[model samples]
Target chain A: MGRTTFHTDPVEALAGVADGDTVLVGGFGMAGMPVRLVDALIDVGAKGLTIVSNNAGNGETGLAALLKAGRVAKVICSFPRQADSYVFDGLYRAGEVELEVVPQGNLAERMRAAGAGIGAFYTPTGVGTLLAEGKEQRTIDGRDHVLEMPIRGDWALIAAQAADPMGNLVYRKTARNFGPVMATAAATTVVEVRETVDLGAMDPEAVVTPGIFVDRVVTS
Target chain B: MTAQQGLPLDVSGAAEHPEPLDRAGLAARVARDVPAYAYVNLGIGQPTTVADHLDPAQGVVLHTENGMLGMGRAAHDDEVDPDLINAGKVPVVEPPGASYFHHADSFAMMRGGHLDVCVLGAFQVSAAGDLANWHTGAPDAIPAVGGAMDLAIGAKQVFVMMSLFAKDGSPKIVPSLTYPATGLACVDRVFTDLGVFAVDHERGRVVLLEAYGTTAADLAERLTGA
Candidate 1:
């Protein structure tokens, strides 16, 4: 079992988060964004952060608030230009922030590969597009695939619906997006849940993320 | 790779067909064409409306890139749950048999070719079936692909839903893409407000299968996608 600690304070749980760290934020958009953790991160005053998420951010809150604070140095995301991604859009246009656009499936699979301890893998997702340029390509069984490497994270900030004392988690609906995979890929995985249940209360099969992958759990 | 050249609807026989469909009409048309019980994904924006037009009895399941399958229609009133949202960040309902998974597994379903059909909105589609929906190639435009590239290449059949002509009155179905490409030779069928088109990537041809409120000859004359 992983030594996962439970926290009541967001700032205290995110105390170790430092500047220039690569942070993987688990959310499809605002749905799974760990709002409390992000707020605490902003309070932690971490600078030059590299954020990885699906959407850049929505409106002037959560991830967008962090980006608006000019704390993010780069964003490695599948989609960065949503309707209210003004904070990121402005920074990108001014050359203040760096961006790496990956195909959505490739982004998810790369993180999955990192967590699964797999080396590089190939897929036909981005083949023949600008994204596959100058990359390794192989003809596997008459189909071409573009080689993509794993993307590891220094810390993962994810939100879930419920968590047990051992850090076993269950998410609600589509909010499960990147949480489970990100929890496995990061060196330190911290989660925010709406409530904490007793141990053994969660069914083993129903747990989206096991306790072994989580390092910290905070009830917010 | 060779697109089968044919028409399900007769455009040659009917001199007077129905008027060009409005947004809802176009969506209904696309929904009607989806194979029954097929696993489908509707892209964001106008393409999302296709879900509303689908008949619930058809058993067509919806897949969202965010990590859901068997997604229901948009959530409204008190049924809305922030956690139960779609790929577009809009609250959605979960129908019976709805399942959730991690991002990796969710996308694997798409890239693994389990999805039967995916309807997407495009900025332009080449005669060779190339998709240019992500970036406009403008110097100042921020490039954000989302799942456009993956869905374009991964789906068994990629159906493009958009107006045939852009707001500037330029045809969206072109001989070649003017914008940065999302995927090459990916689009299978294109359902536009004016007509239905099939791109034969092998022959680099775009065939006007059917037209509405206009004649196929007029579309053929206007479209440079041959």
Candidate 2:
């Protein structure tokens, strides 16, 4: 309805996030993670948060740091345990954190479904595995598929290589993982970028995520 | 030589028996089967070793679940790109013509059955071709089931890389799986330290295709306890 505002301060951009809210942090391992936004969230000290991401971060960088600060109450991710994910491992083993292990494909689809306004969908990804336990099942075209619900977040923290004045974003290389899907799946999407340019500076053809899905942009 | 040409068996010692191939040997055996121009996805663990054994001239393209196609071998300390890692979170190199996409699109490639073959590590594979490798359901087990389920059912052909027997000498290829199942009748072939098995899902039987250090008869006997 109005022009998007760019915040130079990460905390001011992420001030809308409250405690005990579902937050989606976009990244695959350490790449594409909103590090500055995460650090800002740490400064905000929002506790009892639910984090959804591809990983639990390798070390105390992004999601791992939030967990180490005793902010995260649960983590829903594809891979929660890595060689350097000692923070999650220790907290999980000590019964301090809850975890929901979703298959990578299903995780992406769930987020995409939420963004697309799809209520639910059936996928053959985890049909006969433990991930299918207690979920609805059906046979379609003589193949087994498990029903998965859409995943929506109260807020989404994303990282992009460049952002236009209107909040249109572009990501670099493999670092683009989960950024687009998450940009649309959250109630409020805040993006961290290296730089921002004029509205007409970016070619429409090169825009991966339109400004319609983004709420705020912060340059770090 | 191909794995079909079984290794020599020691006959001088009456009590000495043939030793199974080590992890590298098993990986080489799997790598030799990858056809040229094939788009392959190598799972974590032992299956990743297949990439190292593959001939660079084979033209085989590697795919990682995190969304990179045309992936190359594991990166060295100096070449490691922190942002470029495989599904295992291990650093990797991007081969020529490599492309990266969104996570959803990558899964679409896998679930849409665009890959020619996917090599995965397994705990147990039944004679009927059922695979169970994700979780053992042990209290101490973390139950991290990354992309194995998608790869197991989505790949055009699934090849499992594991040892013929567990550390306790119990056969991993059994008449029926004792652990939780990952996929039903999805496994096409299994490469083990001892031999390769072609699963006849229609007949619910396993056929020994090749062996490393033992005769087919001896391996069959060990498999069926004849």
The top-ranked prediction according to TM-score is 1
Fraction of true contacts kept, per model? 0.93, 0.73
lDDT of each: 0.87, 0.85
Determine which window of 10 residues in candidate 2 chain B has minimal summed lDDT: B7-16
lDDT of 2 by residue, A57-176 (tens): 777777888899999999999888788999899999999999999988889999999999999999888877778899999999999889999999999999998999788988877788
lDDT of 1 by residue, B1-226 (tens): 1121221222343243569878998999899889999999999889999998888899899999898999988899999998888877788888889998888888888888989999999999888898999988888888889988889888899999999999988888776777889888899988989988777766777767768888776765556322
- List DockQ, one per candidate, in order: 0.85, 0.66
In candidate 1 the C-alpha lDDT for residue A111 amounts to: 91
State interface RMSD in Å for all models: 0.9, 1.4
> How many Å off is the CA of A195 in candidate 2?
2.4
Candidate 2 local lDDT, B69-128, one digit each (tens): 988777897998777888777887877799988888988888899989999988899877
What's model 1's lDDT at A77?
97
How far residue B92's Cα lies from its native spot in candidate 2, in Å, is: 3.0
The DockQ assigned to candidate 1 is 0.85
**Best-fitting candidate, measured by lDDT?**
1
